[model samples]
Target: MTGSRSSSRRALLGAGAVLIPVAAVAVPVVQRAAERSAFLALCAAWHEAKDTHEQFYADNVRTFEDEQRVAGEIDRLDNVALRLEREIAGAPARTCAEMHAKAKVAERMGERASEDIAHSLVADILREGPGA
Candidate 1:
């Protein structure tokens, strides 16, 4: 009876030993899967925002600026935003300031760069009479 008890104890210990290695390997795989899920979630959210929302801003053009030049400035702001994304290469956990570093860059780009993209997007509305 004592021998049977000893054999069962060894079997339990053997099972635990095998499970230890499996758990060790599984832990990192699970962590990486979680990180991947987080990254994809952020990316998906960013895309959803772009698809579902429109940016709005006011642009007061000086007497001298042409429409073509205004459009080009908006394009340049977009390029700056794109460059910032590449530079930041970051996760969603980044601070709001960090996330908007691009817009800040656009604001710095020129007097109207910050508003150009939104302005160009709705030029017709601005040109048309008010909604009231």
Candidate 2:
């Protein structure tokens, strides 16, 4: 009985050794394909949302509606989103420290863009003589 149990254990160990490499290779391929699919899905959604937003703005423009406030807000949002995209694209190439630094830069850029948009919106309101 002891000899049979030992043999069974050795067989299991041997099987694991053979399985490990197959799993190691397959896991990464599966993960990468899933990641690519997710990225494509997100890109499609982003494009659809962008198109919808643009169409609404275009219709307003056709009516000669005042869109300075809306435009400023959208510009700030778009800039922040663009910075986020840069960070996401850099993620695979970056170490943890590098990614952190890149994230800090993106945050700073987003903050500055928001501030500039606010300043522009205020200026436009003042120049346009009200409610802009």
Candidate 3:
């Protein structure tokens, strides 16, 4: 019984030793995948917000004040998009491929939230009365 217990313990330790390296390798890959997904989602959301802002400008922005406000929002979105682009460029090739594969899905999911953000901004602008 003592020999059997010792052999079982040794087998368990051996298995753990093999698993430790695998887990170590897997953790970074999983973390990178999560980070890539988050980055892509942010980019998709930014695109939606920028598109909504442009549409609002085209359809509803009549006054100079409203135009200026919308333009500023568009510029802000552009700057963030540029930053995201830079990050994407720096990402690993595999990460980029995975992100590209998933981007459209993320964009579709983000559209509603982006519209909400745009609506909130428009409401604030309207409440502030154009020039205020």
Candidate 4:
């Protein structure tokens, strides 16, 4: 019984030794994946907002005031898009690749998913204001 207990403890310690390093490596990979996911969500929302505004203008006649309002909104959205692009450029290479790949998948999911994401993003921006 004593020998069995000692061997069990040794096995447990050996497993921990191996798992600790693996867990340490996995943490950063998980963090990077989360960061990439967030960035991709922002990209999808920005694309949706920009598309909606452009489509509105294209599909309907507009008053001068309406045109001006949309133009300003588009300008603001464009600035947001530019900022997002710059941020993505600064990310790690693997993160950037993941973001781009996920963004492509999000785009292909079409308008419904994008609209929901855009709505959430808009609410957050409104609640937190610019630079949030």
Off by over 4 Å in 4: 55-61, 68-132
**Greater-TM-score candidate between 2 and 3:** 3
After superposing candidate 1, which stretches have Cα over 4 Å from the reference? 55-88, 91-132
lDDT ranking, best first? 4, 3, 2, 1
TM-score of every candidate relative to the true structure: 0.43, 0.49, 0.52, 0.53
> On residues 50-101, what C-alpha lDDT tens digit does candidate 4 reach at each position?
5765676676536877677667666776676555545433433234355354
Which of the two candidates, 3 or 4, achieves a greater TM-score against the reference? 4
Where model 2 places Cα greater than 4 Å from the true spot, the runs are 55-62, 77-132
List of clashing residue pairs for candidate 1: none
TM-score attained by model 3:
0.52
Candidate with the greatest TM-score versus the true structure: 4
Report lDDT (CA) for all predictions.
Answer: 0.49, 0.54, 0.59, 0.59
Ranking of models by TM-score: 4, 3, 2, 1
- The candidate scoring highest on lDDT is 4
The predicted structure with the larger lDDT, 2 or 3, is 3
Model 3: pairs clashing at backbone N, Cα or C within 3 Å = none
TM-score of 1: 0.43
- For model 4, the local distance difference test gives 0.59
* lDDT by residue for model 2 (22-79), tens: 9999999998777655544444444454565567677655443457647775676576
lDDT of 4 at 72: 68
